[model samples]
Target: MKFTEGMWRLREGIRIDWMNNVERLRVENENVELLLNKFQRHRGDTLNSATVTASVTSPLEGIIGVKLVHWAGQVDNGPHYQLASSSGHTKINHEKTETLSYDSGALNLAINTAPNELDFVFSGAKGKLTGHSWRSIGYVGDQTTEKSQWDDGIFFERQGYMLAALDLGVGEKLYGLGERFGPLVKNGQTVDIWNEDGGTSSELAYKNIPFYVSSKGYGVFVNHPGKVSFELQSERTTRVNISVPGEELEYFIIYGETLKEVISRYTALTGRPSLVPSWSYNLWLTTSFTTNYDEQTVTGFLDGFRDRDIPLGVFHFDSFWMKSYQWCDFEFDEELFPDAGGYLKRLRERDLKISVWINPYVGQASPLFQEGKKNGYFIKRTDGSVWQWDLWQAGMAVVDFTNPDACTWFSNHMQRLMDLGVDTFKTDFAERIPYKNIQYHDGSDPARMHNYYTLLFNKVVYEAMISRYGKSNSLLFARSSCPGGQVYPVHWGGDCESTYEAMAESLRGGLSLMLSGYIFWASDIGGFEGTPPPALYKRWVQFGLLSSHSRLHGSSSFRVPWIYGEDCSDVLRDCVKRKILLTPYLLAEALAGYNEGTPVMRPMFLEFPEDLNTYPLDTQYMFGSNLLVAPVFTDEGTVTFYVPHTPEDSQGKWVSWFDHSKTYEPGQWYTETHGFDTLPILIRPGSVTPINPKLKAPQDDALNGLEVLVNGSLANDMAVQVVNPSKTHNVLKVIKIESQSGNVTADDAGVKVVRIGH
Candidate 1:
């Protein structure tokens, strides 16, 4: 994706025709065609012919979309993110002589038709709104007209870009672009918005969203689902440049007073996350990958936890629960789970829910394969051959989510599973949908559907679950997703290794995805790939249990605590208890996420945008707005975090929830070390944090006492949304409390707790 070498030359076969002047401009309906020249004077210059077309489409109110196209007539059906929020098209009046202007959402686009200049002046906070330059236009190579180009181009997408390289001060950093594990601040690296299966080590990401938040207080979302390459002061030392191949490049320039506001507006435009059940936040045990387990093994694990007084809420059966190479058969491996239905009933009797792992692949060995093939449920080539591959399973064919019948056929199996007490689904493998030479029943462009396919696939399964169960009761341990996939509830960092580095990288990825509007995120506790050291397992357990959805899963090993050591049970028990106690507070934050489109787990910038020190600090994140969680990634059990010294109002008081530790002043950096038994969870001034003392299952009544922790100098007020015990995500009560003295009065109106000293 890089076209330039260093600061001067082009890299190898890269040819960039930087447009200097717009020689000729033609307007036809909603399209504007431009003929450009690299130098100045040009009548019919064939040096680098770039014909650019800008199609104006408003997908949502207060937003204008100008999709720039370079090559015409290569409209292929492929994978593309579906933008569903465009509306209210105001008439665009063009001034004579090609000088045209249109305004929307305080953004003014002034076009100098003759000079081929398109300037977007965002009327941001005072004079802080940014603008795009002239050299930002121009498309990449031609789109292939060949029929087989769909699958090959899944890794790439067409784009249009305008770039600026601003200096990152001596300590300037970046954060927020949907759960990334690279540098939290993307100032010194090159990033690509392409989803991959690479674990949290290299730059490759499983959920590569085309968005980034800079510490400089602005976010740029390249509105493309394919591949978008960003050089964050990497190639150009002074600027961040993004390049996408194709006839069109579209990105948004968002500005706000703080990074949180930027997220507010971004999620408003993309999609807000949903509120998951309170129990979903509790500890989840899984039959880890490659581990031998049956009903007896599962019962033994459950019994061990019960004997230890560890409350296990959800039990997930990994891929092996189904017959080998017969994935998605929707039939539990009878050899292993002889009575899946009866076992589920037993789990329900124990007040535990069950979840199963499934992908969209329809293996030939699966009984549903023939039904899908006969009913056109799978994607097919132009030759009418079902697209089959042996990557994960033998003759695995992808279900054509674009086909209504295919979705119905797939949903039916899940619906039946629900009838048998399957509560949730781990919707996996959506990132690997085959695009090339495949045909969708809806006649969708295959290339545009690769990334978008994840949405429909998840939606089909998610909707079926919701319809059969209830909306509030629906959840998915989904792996792959696009922009709007936030509609699904919970997602985990896919396929992590058993190591501290991978654990840290998983945190980075989760933080990045959280920025991209995902409300919930979890990773395999103690990693998913290799056998983790006991130290690593204990550390990962603390981190995972603290997350929105905690699950102990692995690829080739069992994640039962005793397998690591007897001490491991103590670690898991401690974290699980803390999570249960904090469920009252976490669920309230989730409700706010439902309303605000923000993440319960947030990067540093989302909390303190003005504090440049926290921008690149991805090692630590805020569980909600109040508490800061810095996961220990080393054997030393040491964590280094920066707390924005906020000036206390009238009363100077800051308290630590773990221990009523000390009072710290505002506006300074603190390097506080913690033991494996604790992490830095600072409570802000004038905040109320809710803790359920009952500490039963997450869904148990939270109305009694509801020990609201009042951390130092509580000035303003705080609120807690009392979760309904009977119904998931339903608020039985919204308590607004004000704490000044020993007595606390519940505010007449509701409030969200801010227990941290910010």
Candidate 2:
């Protein structure tokens, strides 16, 4: 998607038309209409003239919207949020000097137009916001379907586009591109906001978002469902360049006082995340991909864990639940599962939820393929043929989510599965969608369909559960996503290699994605690509158990704890018990995450935004607002993490939960080595983090034995809540921590604050 020749000149066969002049300005009430062009077109050129009509208006005091329309007949079935805060009435007035400005509540949207330049500056009662300036808007094109060895004429099409990128400040760092597994700081990276299945070790991502936030306290969201390219200090080193193929590009500039507010407002615009079931936060065990297993085999594994006294939550049945080449038939292989519903019921009777793997694929051998083709429920090529691909399955066709009938048909299949006690669907393989020579019922652009397809797929399945089990009980173990995909809860890192390097890479990716505003994260506990040594599995289990969501899955092998030997079960039990004990604290964190779009498993910068070292540190992350979790990525248990100096939490009271004998400081780095049992976990100063020493994840009685640890003499009160994932805060123990008055408690809630220098 890079159109530059060595970052200097435009490539060959490329044509760019930057808006040089605003030829005419017509004002109608609060709306201003302007005609933008490259040059004047004569009568002979009128038919092929490339001109754009931009409509601009101020909907609120600090908000401006520009809707660029090329084809008026297109439907805008908008999935946008209704503005909660609508400001003053807008007024547009034109001056004699050819400058048209809209005035509203001391905020002015001035359109300074002349022969070769245009500028829209927004300054208001509160502050100054971002806008466009000289040569900022452009329409560019490249010979697409004309000549390309990459794809056939049926695939690539001649494409024209609009592009823009705003300037970056001296110390500004960019964040959030939807669960990226790269550097936490997005600078020096060339990202395509296109979802793909490139795994954790590559530049490609499964969840790509066209929106990104900055350390300077603003967010930019590209309003495109297509593959939008971002050059974050990669092309120019001082700007975030955004480009999308089409006639026009529009982006929103969101402003807020803090980074968290920016995310809350942004999610408010796109969609709020579905509140996941409290049990969904517990560790999930699965039958790995391409592994052979049956009821006896699965029961043996479950019994093995039970014998070891390790708690098991939801169990997942991966692919191969169906016969080979019959994927998405929505029927369990009767050979393996003679009584599917009865067996699932038995499993659920043991107090476990059930999840199964499914994708939107219709293989040739599947009975539903012909039915879909006959009913036009599958995506079709230009020649009236079903778009068939042999990548994952032999002659598999994708369900056209743009087709309402197809969505209904797909949902019916899911309902059948849910009727059999399948609590959730592992909605996987959405990244490899077709983007060319395809027709949609809604006539949506195919390029846009590539990323938007996942949104539709997850939505359809999520809604199916809502109809059947209700909204509060719905969830998905999705592997791919887009900007709006955050509306679905839990997404995992796909197909990582079984190595320490890949483990670290997974953490980096999770942290990167967390900064992009995803709340829940999970990964293959013992690795997926190869068999790991006992050390690796044990280490990975500890890290995975600490995540907001955890899963044990693999490829070509079973990821059961005993597969690595009985010692691995001990590791699982240890970590799972601790995670259960930490539930009271984690649940409160999840609730706080709802109001502010912070991830339950967070990047270090989110908790310590001022520390420059924290900006690039991705190896470690915060479990919530309090505990710092540094997962041991190596076979050796060496650990390193940063502590920020906060006015509320000073150095003296920082305590290690594992060893109360050891203490740390603020604004410094700590290195320690331990046995296979522990990783680095620290409590910040003046932190009133709660804990429940039990092996249960969800409970209504949170007032029992609430243990609150006060880190230091904090100047402010740290409110303590021992509640579940429903976001209802219960003050089991509320105390005021101060350097002046000391720790004052309202009740005997087993709260303790070891005074620093005591």
Candidate 3:
């Protein structure tokens, strides 16, 4: 994807034709088109050779979309991100001359019809936001001429690449390249927007969304579902370069004064994340992968949580549910689970939801594989053979989600499981889709369908759940996703090591996911590959329980608290209870994510945009808009974090939710030591935090006996919405607690209001 060598020369066989001048400009209906000619001297020189036709239009109120085309006609097979709403012919006010100016909302785009440049400057109510200059547009041609063709002039096969580079201002940082695990600030990094099954330890991401938000209060989303290679300050050092493999590349520029508004607009174009069921927020216990487990194993895991006094919500059955070498057979292993339905029924009677594992693959040993191959339900190769690979399963053939019959065939299998008391499916491994020399049944481009496959795969399963169990109860524990895949409720971080570093990286990945518009995210509590040490296990328990969704899963070892130590059980119990108590606040945040595209686990910059220090602080995040959670990553149970002091921040003192004696001032770094039972969860000043003591399940009706704990000084009116116990409705509760000279006066609606600090 890198085209240049160092700062000067092109690498190997790379050729770049930078559009330098615009020959003609005109407006047709809702689009503005420009006929761009490469460096030309005389009028006759612009007659032939390759030229770029650039079209500019407004897709949303404050979003401007630009598409650059090199070839006139090219077959576009299908697969594009689905936009939630249409722009519907937005009014464009233009002033024509040698230099034409067009304005949409507060976004002003100036086109130099004579020179080769397109500039976008946005001025909102908060003044100048961000701009993309013309020097960033590029049409690259990569070709290698044979030695014989050099003299004969016969070789002309050149791969077309369209690249768009936007200006990166001083001190500007980029975030959200779809659940990245490295540093949060995406500067000096070359990111390829291609989905892969790489674990959370590397630069390769399972969910590579073609979208990013800048600290300068704007976002750019590439419309291409295929690979989008981005050079974030790595290629040009001052500009973020985006390259797509086609003659035409389309992208949208969204404007907002704050990162939250940028996310709102971005999610509005793509879809907003749907609300997950309330019970999903509770603790989930899973049968560890590759571990010997059956009905007795599952029963023991559930009973272990209950015996340890841990509040359990959902129980997940990993890949071993089906017979080996026959994934997607959708049948319980007769040797292990003889009575799958009866066992699941008994678990449901205990008020615990059941989730089973599934993937869009049918191994050759599977009974359904021959049927799928004969019915043309699997992806086919160029030679018309069914695509088969032996990576995860023996001769596993991927389901062709592009085919309607194939989707129905797959969904019917999942629907049958749901009918047998299964509440959810942990849809996994859609990231390993084939793209080379493969064809989709519906004629979708293989490259585009690679990442978009998850969108369809999860959609089929999610809709099946919605059909079986209404919209309020539908959920999928999905793994891979793309731009619009946030519509599905829950996605967890993929395989991770059982170490403190992996735990921290998981948090980093989850935080990055929030920036990418994903609402609820989870990971293996003590990592996925190996069993975590006792210290790391206890620490991960606190962090995992605080996450939007919590699950205990591992590969070779059981994640039962007793496996780690007796102290781990106490830690798990304490963290689960604390998270359950904080359910009212967390559910309110989840509702906001569903309705307004605001992420429940937010990066610090989203809450305090003006504070420059918050840009690179990925170690900590705002759980909702008030509580700051900084997970301890070391064995000593120590953490170092910063509390930003900005005008928009709460105007009172910072209060530690743990020991009331341990309080800190804002705008400073704080290092604190915690025991296995304590984690640093700081509440912002002037915030009203709602809590539910004696918490049970997520559907427990705690609203009738809710406790509104006033954190710091409730200097302003605060409100929190708690979902009804029946999971039917969200009840909005408002409290006005004015901060007097030193005392606070509260207006309570029969709910206990307790102040946190003196």
* TM-score versus the correct structure, for each prediction: 0.89, 0.89, 0.96
Q: State which candidate has the highest lDDT.
A: 3
lDDT of 2 by residue, 218-331 (tens): 677777788789988787666677787666666666656666766776776666655677777677899999899989988888888778888888899999999999998999
Q: How much is 714 displaced in model 3, in angstroms?
A: 3.4
Question: Which is superior by lDDT, 1 or 3?
Answer: 3
**lDDT, residue 164, model 3:** 77
lDDT of 3 by residue, 1-758 (tens): 67888767887888787776777778877788987767677778776567788898887777888888988699989787877545563665555545666566766666665454545555456555555565556678777633223444655566778977777777888999899999888999999999999999999999999889988778888999999999999988878888998898998888876778889888889998888777888888888789999887778877888887888888989999999999989998988988888988999999989999999999999999999999999999989999998999999999998889998998888888988999999999899999999988889999888889999999999999988998788889988999988898799999999998898888889988899878789989999998789999988998898889999999999899988888889899889888888888887778778777888888898998777788889889899888888999999977999988746344566778876666777789988888887777887776777778856766777665677666664444555566654452355555444555222234465677777754
Kindly indicate the candidate among 1 and 2 with the higher lDDT: 2
lDDT of 3 at 14: 86
Q: State the C-alpha lDDT per candidate.
A: 0.72, 0.75, 0.82
Candidates 2 and 3 compared: the better one by lDDT is 3
Task: Indicate the TM-score of model 3.
Answer: 0.96
Which residue ranges in model 3 land beyond 4 Å of their true spot? 6-8, 85-93, 116-135, 145-155, 646-651, 732-748
Q: Which residue segments of model 1 deviate by more than 4 Å? A: 6-8, 21-48, 55-64, 76-80, 84-103, 106-123, 126-129, 141-174, 647-653, 671-673, 715-718, 725-730, 739-743, 746-758
Q: Any residue pairs clashing in model 2, and if so which?
A: 179-513, 181-509, 686-712
Q: Worst 10-residue stretch by lDDT in candidate 1? A: 157-166
